[model samples]
Target: MGRSRPGPIRWLWYAVGGRLPDEYREWVLYDLTAPTWVLRHLCRAMVQHSVWLLLLLLPIPLTLRIWMVVTGVSVGLFFSLAFIEDASERRLIRQGFPVGLNRKIREESSGAQRSELAAMYAAYYTTEPDV
Candidate 1:
């Protein structure tokens, strides 16, 4: 667990959007190399179903064309989020990124993050006044 940027609500925002935040992205996607389609689909379903159900249950009757369009878009968004990580990795490999690049980046960013927090706390909580 590290300090959240701006705030922690961003974690929920990224999870709902099917995108991991920067702090979590490298660990989940690269270090663990976790397959996330199932999880992302579950998240997408929660949002998509709520939206589609609202449309389906609307008092105004919808034409077949409108219904089809909504269904098509919902499916497309679900599929895209489900496979986004796999697609991103494939693209990175194609671009010739090193296999351990994520690990290296994580280490550098972690150290910088810690130091920044340390400096901030030191400044804010320091009891001794400057001469």
Candidate 2:
């Protein structure tokens, strides 16, 4: 998917109905390619579980006083996506991607890009250090 080369606004795309904001690109890629096993699970959760945000709208119409639950979930999601992106950098640290790999990708340098298969191979070999 990343090989298709997204634009500057690569956050998401559209689907059926109104055709808006249902398909996620970068988030999906991150979830799939997360450097650590923990990060992969975490990123997947952030992308897949965002539908819970709609519960806030339900509480208002249902006369449910869910302010605390709503507020906490709101804050959690607000930080979760950004946290996942930050955590993706650990891939570089774990696989020993040379310095500035993140910058290279952000710069859209084709030469700096690794094939998805190669990345998957590296991820397969990554193991947590014994503490």
Which candidate has the highest lDDT of all? 1
lDDT of 2 by residue, 20-91 (tens): 121332333333343443554454445545555566665365545365446656676566555654544553
> For candidate 2, what is the total of clashing residue pairs?
0
- Tell me the alpha-carbon RMSD of every candidate: 11.3, 11.8
TM-score of each: 0.33, 0.33
After superposition, candidate 2 runs with Cα above 4 Å error: 1-65, 91-100, 109-131
lDDT of each: 0.45, 0.43
Expressed as tens digits, the lDDT of each residue in 1-131 for candidate 1 is: 34334244654454344444434433333322223434644553455445455455555657864685577667867675676555445433432343543333434545446444333432333344589
TM-score of 2: 0.33
Distance from true position, residue 43, model 1, in Å? Answer: 2.7
